[model samples]
Target: MPDASRITPPVVAPTEAPVNPVSMHIRLDPGMPLAHLESVYHAVNTEKNAQGIYQLTLQDAQVPANRDFELLWVPAPGNAPQAALFNEQWQGDEYALLMLMPPAPAPAGATARRVPREVIYVIDTSGSMHGDSIIQARAALKLALERLTTADRFNVIQFNHQTSALFSRAVAATADNLQRALSYVDRLVADGGTEMLPALQLALGQQPEQGVLRQIIFLTDGSVGNEQALFSLIHQQLGDSRLFTVGIGSAPNSFFMTRAAQFGRGTFTYIGKVAEVGEKMAALFSKLETPRLTDIEIHWPQDQPVEMWPARIPDLYLGEPVLVALKLQQPNLPLTLTGDAAGVPWQQQVTLRGGAARSGVHQLWARRKIADLMDQRAQGVAEPEVRKAVLDVALTHRLVSRYTSLVAVDKTPSRPADQGLENKALPTNLPQGWSATKVFGSLPQTATASEWNLLVGLLLLACGVLFSRWPGVGFGVRVGPVSDGKAHGGNVL
Candidate 1:
């Protein structure tokens, strides 16, 4: 036989060197001449608008104009997984992106339900939750209570360093219970460390009432550090309960609260302003009142090699759809989705063919994959394996994960190693009508809360709830502060 290895042609990279990989860190010297400084400022700040530059006439994302939930296949260019061999692209195994847009919410008058419910209201009273966050939480809790019917059973659990419940067990949402619960909520004060695990345990650890929709509406600024511990607890103890997370504040821990809801098999809602509490909470409560779809199953064409994110599919509520990202050997095939919607067997089908490819599908898929990996890490997967896997995906997709970070470094040192650097701290501008940001997550970092920050929170809510809610691929571009002094760089994320 001929030498097979020699017969095959060798694959070569498109370029011998990286085209654009390095991010530069530049600083100006304080001792620079005035003319040089002025020139530098003008050159950096001036935006030379290209006169009538040719722009792509094509629209970016291939989403329908209507709100109807449609199953879509967003294949990569030529079914590719990466762009270039290096830089601004993911060099990894090839796959395609699929999205299942959620159905629009049920009609306002429709969703009158007879099935019973057990609603658990958990609020964070940690010191960081003081001010607007606490007020928002209290108002949200009160609204949820008013929506509860007598047929529903409910309890209120508040936690800081300590955790307490309004009832030893879930009580009927009667006049008396509602009154007492309101009284209990009114006395809550934000003045302790954020101890969330015990509260989660109290909310999810208990057994469910037979034939009742067990739902937990958790309200918090999400200023907690023990995310892994809390996620594990939610995963283990969450037998049949659904969790809905309400992120309360301008810059709450969207990562923690969003993932917590994912693990608890629920959705995330964000209340940015006190004015938004009424509308957003009412919308959420409307969905809560409706019956949720259960026992969902996706049937792909026979014997196709399938690798999908969200290995376990959760039940869907009203306004929530079945969104999935996966890899397939056969891209052009039929797909079937089956589920139980309020005791009714519901199934939908779509033939995989296309109009146009969606933008950033690979990033969306990689994002879901990273979240899945982090879920494994939180569920006690070996640290090294999870880290390596996450790093591969994160680095390949150019995303920020627990395993990867965006860094800025000044390669050239400004002073001698033995010299100490000192400077006066500049005053940070916070958003109007907000207190200082609360430190959150495994590591501590401070961020200024603004209308834009709340917008970020809304975008991070849930993938199933909205196709646009995928984790952002990168950070915002910020223009550095204008100054005559020498510039120094620090890692922002």
Candidate 2:
């Protein structure tokens, strides 16, 4: 196993003040009329896990008190759609709005019979889910299993380095099956690397069950990186299937869960603690039971070409507000919303004029637009086009996108020209309670570069290949400690 101890650098005394300082040369355009500059500094961020909910055992009945806080939610119009407008610094009029769809009464006889659903519950059993995370996951899955009705067929899938299912396929939600699933979930102990692609493939690669609504519920902290591949898979294989995300653990990746749900045309629910699992899962299931407005469309004033995101509107669920970002030439124009709920046509009109004038709406629009471009790039869009478009919006709005970053550039140098810059990388300690096995397949980014005096015991065999055109072909290096008051040396072949 790799060394787990933290390595600290030699402490510098307060009296010593003779060292080489480092600086950068930032070139500025001569044509600029005005430019501002400041010193660049980065404050290190440290995260302390104070949830006090780790290593919880099944027998531990003592639940930790949840830290509560008051929330201030400005309610929007319940009867009509609402909008928030912001005029961007650039040319276009940017705005963001919540396309709230009041529950449309289903058509007569349309809701007489409930549709059977094929629910596939997937839980991540990776090493990151080892403490309270896994416990919360188990609790969420248990509650979800209890909510299954007799008309629904369900299966439980758990994944780490490998994927396993309670049943080979979806089975009827009978008492026997539910009991078996509950047992399987209870026995799950998080202890392996996260290989999420295989699990996603197994869950979504199959054909949807006939005459049943297919829904995939993922309960995980979403620590698996490389979300681009997963998003692409969900986009390609999602055929008439909805995917709901249940974020487990305190530090669950909200971006990943939310985006996965967006691509799967589903909703995202978060369970921060074990105590909140039942209520959150119950709310999610309640939304699933309500009517979903599908085939949503927006009608903007025809005075200018309007850019709206997501380019394709998603289905609306109960009490879930659809946040829409728009770019238009006019701000106060009326826009119409159209959709169908259980074969019943739904329509509402709202103008952005009387809506609250909120700040940062333009930033929201830019961020969503950038995300839309990135989604396209993931779906095989041209790299240059996407980069150029994203860079333009990101720079004009001064927002950080995947392509653009804000770097503080000083007009003057911090050190003398003759002083050579020496950069020393500091070692980063391993995260508390984390295993070195977490980095088995990848290089450790926290490892620092330090001086190593290798003692190559007398050269047993020497071979060297001098490069002509290609320099990194091969090389022979030999060095040893000094002997007899003389330094031992060898060729850098």
Candidate 3:
């Protein structure tokens, strides 16, 4: 795992202090189906014996270079569609979970140790995070400071209905500076309703010119009322800096935390237990140090009929593997690829000629891409015409798709009108779970030449019978059986 300090170079003199790097946040939604979840996380294990409402399980993964981070999420009974958004960071060997469903209590073994970084601990001392919440918040910040080095620069921010900065901008991490910051944190007693928007705006506006990575570690229970307003602002300003969010208590709303990080391109975590702060910090520091692949873009030829999920991929974190699904028109074709690797441009070509006969792999890839397309559609960014085109192809191939399905219909008619004969009546099927809604017309009947011949023969037989019954025609009657002794009963012809 790369230490967070790795991103920042040390300053040689007093005037050359570096800017602290900020964390990024990513949000997740609950309505994610099992297939969608698998696409996000590399590992998903079905418990062999554990039977319950929540059937999926996730195991913690070590951060590996060149791979994406994996996060496992299991739904609670009756969980809503947009329950939570999770953020995670991968160190080389260990993955740091930033958020999850109901935001599970931080691991008992979890801890946050601040790594050497020019740092700023932005605490929301607003009245919203008061009492026990305030106390825990203070402890979390203290724990964070314990990991800093004197080489780092730091400051604090406390916001309520009003906002205040401990120092105008970044402060050196000298003993006096640390003392002043600690004093400010200790003196923080939460009061007043949360007015977080201006505080964040001010915190970000204080960016220093120091070459070090600039960061703002936001501490809050995320209870501010104006979440939408704050989200809009975060979305607007995130590109300027990195922001990490720490949700202080059990009820802390982690949604805002996750959104803030995502917009700011940083990490989001819920700190339910103060004791575990140090370890979590350690994991985070390692991630900050590593840069597996920057500006990753995966591409393939246009004619391959291959669809890649997550058309817009995010940064690859420690330990998480990047999984790409390819739908190939022909299996043996060689595919050209190009992308940036850690700031350097590179290109490679790969052949998909190997044993693709493995059961279910292709199906899995198809399902994943389809799901991704659905997600894009839901976001309202997908082009309807293009999507419809893709859907048609999926239907023709009978591939699993979000919008198309193989539907069964029954065509048995209950009455003469329903027989779907003349009068332009259309045929209607009795779908298992559905009722007929329209009576547009009748069924179309097409007969073969042989069937027509049979119909003509029957018509001729009927005509002959009617002609024989005409008044001028002779009739014969036999009253007795042919073998009868009387043989009598004339046959009058």
Candidate 4:
């Protein structure tokens, strides 16, 4: 019988490399209000033209002439900001990329409800707030108060190294009462270290009663050092009261303020110029009147493997409702959804199949928001397992997360010396644990000292023999074996 080893086939190990998942990061300019939705879509589909304006074409984004997405817009405070939601289900993993379209400009004649709102202006009077920061903050508060309707209720809370409430709780928005509150705001002088945690705690402690649209507008210009602490404090106290944040100064710690507002379920506005305060206040108050749409929710049933970015965050913005796009495993069913608006919910559904996913650019935006949410509070999770799960998903998906960035998962080794050169072609003739760049397509320097000496000796011996055996006619002149002697002086020497 033939030997078993000779008869059996060799097991060839697979050499295929693993594929990396692709993710796209698109930035949405918060400057655009609502009128720019079409422009946003154009920007999404076509390349910007010479003037930086988006050129719209039917072929762009593969949108048909009659194609239109169900538009839901919600107005909010700051810059006439509107939420946009686009619902569609497209097939294929290729379409699972994130797309952040630019926000549109504000539209005309947009209105909100005229409900009673109680707003508390929390001004940071820390010593650091001294100067233009305090001045601008006071002006911004005054401007915001001017925009408030008579039916609204208001109060002022000033905090620095400590917390100070104008009154124990909220007060009615009366002309004389508002004037008295403005007087207190004008007297605010910044002169203490930012112990923002205590101030925030105090503000959150006074929970506004029900049926009142309670909000706290926090203005700051410096780092409090206890940002995470403040976020936790706010999250703990979060219950009906929304915390809007206004970042003052040219270079404030925006990350802290932004996250603070986000955690408090409020809006964030940045003041680039002093003059912007009134406009921002007006825009914010305008949102108070109109019910953009209530009961805002994203409905993607768990029938298939569906992932929505920003799964827990609020809706997307157009000019009315936030723009939301969903990715679906089965698009033929036409995914339908609704957003609750000030107790009024709007329903929308769309069917997607086959090539429809390619046109469903909104789905990419959804994934991106989800990525943002994942990275938002990685440190806050109680369990390392949960944090690791989020981090792993973020790493695998390449989401722009704070906790898990692209470089977070280090495939590279910590110590270069410890890593052996991973050469696929080099044979393992090297000593164990030895790691060096293996020379390829070249012979190794294997000649020992003795061998080298022997080679040189052999070469010298050949040269000496050739020189001695040469036939010479005269000293320093030689005649070859077949030379016809011509009496040439310069003959072979």
Candidate 5:
């Protein structure tokens, strides 16, 4: 055959490697128009697997400047004109899902009054947060202190190997106290191992002052490995106090920060760069000063079997809405949500009806269930049972979890039997406004291990080609030489 493969030679190397892929799952009202989005995201690989469920894969995804999803409603079957609930048929299923949005905040100059806050700032001074992390944290704490009014009482708690409080107890937000706090924060330095349990114990164990909104704002790089223990401590001691975690570093453990806040019945915030400290802290302060919706309870119809995630709802802050997901055996039931805003009773009710069948709703419910199970596991639930439950949910939904990961393998092996695979770590960028030299004591190299591997592969491939062309060289021809099967070349060994 005169070596047909040799007659039409393939290119051995690509000019550039492909970018990393980003995946997104979205659910909307079934049959909604998608032409506009298709045009905008032309390069994305998008497909609708089921009604109202879409999967999108894009290379090197970037955030859109304007992105929003507004829920669509349709008239319910046999629904009264005056009925408060509206429904759309679930696109592909028999079950109907109900949604209710809380009433909007009262207009400015309304009767609602701001609550007095008792604030405790918990800061981490671990060795990993030696430089830019500590600097930005101090700046953020100072800004928080400045936002305190005379009506507020405040304390500062910093932790490393041990914990210390700036005052014996939370003191009035007086001029003298504020200045002393500022000086105290300035003199703080980062050192020692992270021992967060003691800090959290001190912050939450204090007897809460009656009628005051108690909040603990925790700032840290979230580098500790013993997350389960900390979560247990927070749940045990978190009587009437809320713990809000502020992620502080170029890379923080997002899973820990988010789940900790969820368990603490509070919200989480992130300040990735020094410049964002002011903006984020200001927003947090606004939420702190506003009247919150508390003691939230959702009343489902007594007759039907209903399952809902997030058994306990967190208090709602200003401009925040309440969302819950549930699966019901029967339809056409009424759901009532009740809460208190500034001691004024507030309630909203919505009747259930078949809505456009959305694809990802089931998966969303599954994720929440898995998260709840994890929280239970952290709080002394049986390990084997919880692990099995989490694994089942994760595998069913094809979602990644601590125990399960998403992995792909090719059917065909491209490398020689003698070849060895190399692994490398990827390098992440420093946060904006942070100096590399200051953070690391010197400017560190930015090249990732993958880049080095690619370079070495190219060099070896070049050498192979040169050796193959030699007069006396004779080797069995393989179409591709790259371990990943993405490169085309003949192996010479």
Candidate 6:
């Protein structure tokens, strides 16, 4: 047997400043001798066991986000080319596992041709979106509108407490119409509650023109409480309309934005800084203009029982690959994928091969499963049942989720329960380009006609009550009986 004691841990310098604590684990194929372990960042702790699995924990900092896989594979004598494996368990159960990169772009003029698009821009102008948030949103919308061609149809919908469209229906992206849209977006102000449901309904309700790609680009801080409702609406009305979300704040609600885009079968973009608005929106426009891979399906070996997360595959943007984690009973099984690109059918097949054992793939898969379960809960699954399922998966994988959080407890108690606990809030810096006065000073104009209508309704109701009690008043005409004999002595007004 090869001596596992002879292996040496890699010596690597830290690549980047760590923003959050990260932990990683790697499991090698059974009977595979540990030749070496290498990483770009020094691991705070490294431990190897009899089962050929290695675990590493990084405290406070880890490798840079942009860096590729840390473990560099060194093939042993007569070893085949090895793909990367994050984590695995070798139990008696049968399952399947596979990972694949995005297919290369088809040869020039060989793939499906681009389709004309009908773009709808839905922007949130709620109170929380004041300052830099609204500014970035407006700039992004202008960029998208400028990219539309004359052959395309386009419209703009701005929502706060009420929803209003730039046009009653989508109009040709003429120069005049595009200019009008830019001006309309420029005049939008951040105020009122985030009424996204109505805006989404209006955008999705648009009739799809033949041969035109219907897409909705939504920009918001995602600061709404009714995220589930919006998600359900998107799922129900999605039809052929793809919804992309542009997160537009320093600390936007990422959970809502990411899942919404997933349900809408589109991609999500983040614009944390004003400078990134142009760059991010430009990238998004590229995806919008290109043909996307849709109706993707993966076929695994029939002999292997496979369990995968994100059971519903999302549409692939340009250069975006389909990634999934599977608990397989066997390794090195061949797989096939089929999908549609534009209007043409596309398919690919690959034979799985042994590769270098990487780390974190299992945890990534677990995170995806948890997200899917939560999405199901949002879609009306029983809360207790979904919570239980999520908790079991999270606890088994030791992941952080809505039902599970990583908490550190001290064995020795420093303070008694009777000492009482004091709550302190931490102050956060204002988002870049935001003004404190605008955000906190005076409230913007958010009052809507609904308030006036409510007052009028109350007044009318009171007047009716008074008139009923004092029939002598001439505020309303009263009839003692109906001429058609519908009523004998009933009062009518």
> Please, what are the lDDT tens digits per residue for candidate 4 over residues 211-273?
877878888864465555677677778788888788775445676776676677666666644
Give per-residue CA lDDT, model 2, range 17-71, as digits (tens). 4233322222222111112222212112222234411121212233222111112
Model 1 CA deviation exceeding 4 Å by range:
1-96, 102-108, 319-322, 395-398, 405-493
Tens-digit lDDT string for candidate 3 (1-493): 0221221122222233323322222244333333224324234444322222234433433322212233444444221111121221112111111111121223477653433455667787754465556777888787676656776777788887688888887877778878877777788887655667788888766555545666678888775556656666665655445677877753566656875765565677655444546665555544554434445555556665645544544444332234455554554555544444444564545555432223344455556555555434324444685478558657744785556777888799657875654563222222111111110112112211346678899998888798798887644555655664334655544
Q: Which residue runs does candidate 3 get wrong by more than 4 Å?
A: 1-118, 302-312, 319-493
Of 2 and 5, the candidate ranking higher by lDDT: 5
True lDDT of residue 367, candidate 1 = 92
Q: Model 1 lDDT vs. the true structure?
A: 0.65
Clashing pairs in 2: 476-493
Once superposed on the true structure, which residue ranges of model 4 sit more than 4 Å away at CA? 1-47, 50-112, 313-328, 331-333, 340-345, 352-380, 399-493
| lDDT digits (tens) for residues 1-493 of candidate 5 | 1222221122111233323323454433434323223413224555666554565554335432111112222322221111132233332322333343334445677755767889999999876577678988999999999989899999999998889999999999999999999999999898766778888889998956789989999999876667788899988888888889998865666778888998888887776667778877887877767636678787976777767777887777643444566666556667777777667787766666634444566667668888899889777899999999999988877888879997888889788889999864443334333334333332124222356678899998998899789997655645666776444566443
> At residue 292, what lDDT does model 3 achieve?
40
lDDT of 6: 0.69
Ranking by lDDT: 6, 5, 2, 1, 4, 3
How far in Å is the alpha carbon of 87 misplaced in model 6? 6.0
Error of 2 at 358 (Å): 2.5
TM-score for candidate 5: 0.68
- How do all models score by TM-score? 0.66, 0.68, 0.47, 0.58, 0.68, 0.68
In angstroms, give how far residue 51 of model 1 lies from its true place: 23
Best by lDDT: 6
Q: Assess each prediction's global lDDT (C-alpha) against the native.
A: 0.65, 0.67, 0.52, 0.55, 0.68, 0.69
Worst 10 residues of 2 by lDDT: 63-72
Looking at model 2, residue 466 earns an lDDT score of: 24
